[model samples]
Target: MRWSSWVLFAAGIATGANAASLTQVTENFGPNPRNVGFYIYVPDKLAVNPPILVNPHWCHGNAQVCYTGSQFATLASQYGFIVIYPDSPNTADKCWDVSSNATLKHDAAR
Candidate 1:
């Protein structure tokens, strides 16, 4: 649950965002991935020509208002780049061969 802990720590940051839409997109990149939990937010304006970015761990979906992400997201768009945040899978710790984090459960792809 380290990722969730970090998300909780950064909860204060994504409080006052300027964007309009947040989306959780899931695509079957390959037949091998039954569920590749990933998430992204496209600013309200990027409904059509928005950019796509690849970053890890920004929003934990528990934050009511993502204050920390607002400015950074805005800046990324200002620089002609769209920002993307990836949700860590329940198996992030698997690389260490450690016990699973029971709380690290994923909901259906929204």
Candidate 2:
């Protein structure tokens, strides 16, 4: 089956169920020079070594708004995967620093 069709089928299975909301991660994972906000959504039934889905918000968008407005949380619940929503540190424009090479390199923000 097509990937899109499979997702739709899975989402349909838990139509009335309440998916878990995103939770802010307080503990530091590592150096965050950009001061980006981290949020996560863990499904009730998690798959072994589940793949992570990073859902970064668009310009002028925050983690909470993206979580509530998108299907990532619901899909995570249905598919038993983890979802991460990272809030950009660029408060001036509320956008990610994609133009900078430092931000693009692996663990460059540190």
Candidate 3:
């Protein structure tokens, strides 16, 4: 799937329930040239090969803000799925690098 599409999918889930705190993952999953922060919310109970939800925060926001301010984590807990919060590498404004060529390309040097 495209990188930009996950935002819409995450917005469609139900909200307003309490969830566990987000966990920061230091393990390198791939070539993170931009050094984006990876935070995940894995429920106490997980389904078999459960689906994942990538929840990115808005401008001036980070993974912690997105995780605590949204219902994706709560939904993940209730529905047995995983929620991944990808933080922007940009430290100034904290917005994603949507204008970059690498970001526009799929399976690029991520």
Candidate 4:
């Protein structure tokens, strides 16, 4: 999808971010050239420069939903860290781009 389309989609999801103690944030890393967007879950309270966890989704799945369903969020809340869920370049599959080095680099570099 185009960058503008992704921005719209990200904005749509971000509407509900402030609903609770756990806030969800959307960030676009398209400037890196692959047009990747990510969802980050941050606890209402955090320590100084908390650590981060990068969670990737499986094929044709949702990364934020997965992270939300896992124990990671709970741990992050308790431990005061950040959890990031990056969307695949191909959202259709939602799979980590393990196809090639360049693809993998794109995923890692973001």
Best by TM-score: 3
What shift in Å separates residue 110 of candidate 4 from its native position after superposition? 17
Candidate 3 achieves a global lDDT of 0.71
Off by over 4 Å in 2: 1-19, 105-110
lDDT of 1 by residue, 1-110 (tens): 36343332222122226343344444333331234354444444433443445555433332113424456566654554455555444454412212344324443232
- Candidate 3 C-alpha lDDT tens digits along 1-110: 34434322332222213234476666445455678887777776767776888899999999999888998878987898878898898999999888766899866764
Error of 3 at 110 (Å): 13
lDDT of 4 by residue, 16-103 (tens): 5552133344454245466565666666555576676778777887766677668877887788776667667785676766666676
Residue pairs clashing, model 2:
none
TM-score of 3: 0.75
Clashes of 4: 1
Clashes of each: 9, 0, 1, 1
Candidate 4 has its poorest 10 consecutive residues by lDDT at 19-28
- The alpha-carbon deviation from the true structure for residue 1 of candidate 4, after best TM-score superposition, in angstroms, is 23
Each prediction's RMSD over C-alphas, in Å, is 12.1, 9.2, 7.6, 7.0
Runs of candidate 4 with Cα error greater than 4 angstroms are 1-30, 104-110
**Weakest lDDT window of 10 consecutive positions for candidate 3:** 7-16
The whole-model lDDT of each prediction reads: 0.41, 0.71, 0.71, 0.61
Clashing pairs in 3: 31-110
What are the models' TM-scores? 0.39, 0.74, 0.75, 0.63
TM-score of 4: 0.63
